[model samples]
Target: MPIVQCVPNFSEGRDLEKIEKIVQPLRCKEGVKLLNYEGDKNYNRLVVTVIGEPKKVKDAVLESIGVAAELIDMNNHKGQHPRFGATDVCPFIPIKDMTMDDAINLARELGKEVSERYGIPVFLYENAATKPERENLATVRKGEYEGLDEKFSDSNWAPDFGEAKKHSTAGAIAIGARRPLIAYNINLDTKNIEIASKIAKTIRHSSGGYRFIKAGAVEVSERNMTQVTMNLTDYTKTSMYRAFEAVKMEARRYGVNVMGSEIVGICPMEALIDVSAYYLGLENFDLSNVLETNLME
Candidate 1:
């Protein structure tokens, strides 16, 4: 069976009951395996990682989206993460015996189905984007939920699937195919969001920072700390250690200490290995050195 990984980010992270309800469909699905899931109260977002046959994975994702739409109301939703829908962004990643094209096709199929069935506008992003501009998710979600209404008025901003108008409570969804990405966040000790924002701007791609990094500053109100949340688009180009160091180096200038770091959902083991090798100063350390790597073989 051809395997594909789907990470669907839903907008209700604070409510455990609703989050469980949203992910209930993925639990007993025959062909799908729920690898992991995490809810961040700070961002008010839920990140779920699952892998299975392409069609089965798509089916599971669609079911979860429906549940998310029914449970989460974006109209009253508030969080540190930028989102425009109940099921904010869903990305499909090809894993075993699958190609990028196969993932793209699955994304399109899921997008069409979700749009037709739920009446929510769907935008194809990343590799599945229809236009060059839409290729970047940040660009596709430029206006966020608040500006979604006016965004639909522009011809250039019309959705790739379903009506251009936004869903009353569920809002809109972005579905696409892309390579594996790491959702890493670095927390700072000080409660000043400005320091976090500055560090984010210095390390993110849009601000002429790293090549494959998209970053933003978020306030974790409950903890009274700030975070530099990031999406490492291609870890091969810009490793996790480099991003972490960049924030650490920048934080020093603001006299802020590094609180800790977090990985939102499942990440490739190689990414962690690379970080370990760098921090440990181990020469030529690779997956071959990992005991689990040999066991898998």
Candidate 2:
């Protein structure tokens, strides 16, 4: 009866046939619901969201990771997103009747199985990280795929599971347990990636921005625009509207227009409610005011 959500990011996005094949295991599986899966051609990445009974969800994700390992070749991979493996990063979050400890155990279980079965090295990150330095995903992915060999050479950079070496075609993966975070992106109506990058640096934590924000810039080539992509690690502390408004304020300095914004995967309803209250200038607004919130109960 324990519920958990798993979001597995794969390195392939352009090829629809392969994308479907990779996610086939999660589709129509008992005790598991495939909430959403999005493929971004520009980033060349697929983000899949699924929530279900903990064990069933784990099995489905493991099967899909195997499919990704066989189908995706990291040597021929290229994208604006930083990645080091076929199944780049997989994080498990406790949903219902579950605790963080349960999620961490599930992450360790999957990490070990994937490493032994597919020969892919795994790094436990975030709450499941063995070392303080490995807790931040950015630090874990610093060198990326190209620098994997050099990274493996250092004793301090050894993986949590499997050999110290990276897989030839599949590379390596980061499996972790963490609190839910929103992956949001704001688009700017300009092909100038520098402007987007500047805005990203201004609002990201690493550059003295918001404490719970991790951000970067990427080009949305097909749309002829640039995007300020971000992960709002704690919405309660740093809210979505605050990040959106900050980006708008910075973009105005460069005379750039806000194209729009998007949430990459599923997000808490409270996050959207906060945004609505801010934009509508509502007084003392909360989830209780929403009709659907009451109906669900």
Per-candidate TM equals: 0.96, 0.98
RMSD of each: 1.3, 1.1
**TM-score of model 1 (CA atoms):** 0.96
Candidate 1 per-residue lDDT, tens place, 1-297, comes to: 799999999998889999999899999888999999889887789999999988998998999999999998898998878899999999999988899999999999999999999999999999999999999998888879998999999998888899999999999999999999999999999889988999999999899899999999988887898999999999988999999999999999989988789998888999999998899999977899899999965
Clashing pairs in 1: none
Candidate 2 lands at a TM-score of 0.98
Tens digits of lDDT, candidate 2, 1-297: 789999999999899999999999999999999999999998899999999999999999999999999999999999989999999999999988999999999999999999999999999999999999999998898888888999999999999999999999999999999999999999999899999999999999999999999999999988999999999999989999999999999999999989799999899999999988889999987899999989976
How far off is model 2, as Cα RMSD?
Answer: 1.1
Highest TM-score: which candidate? 2
lDDT (0 to 1) per candidate: 0.93, 0.95
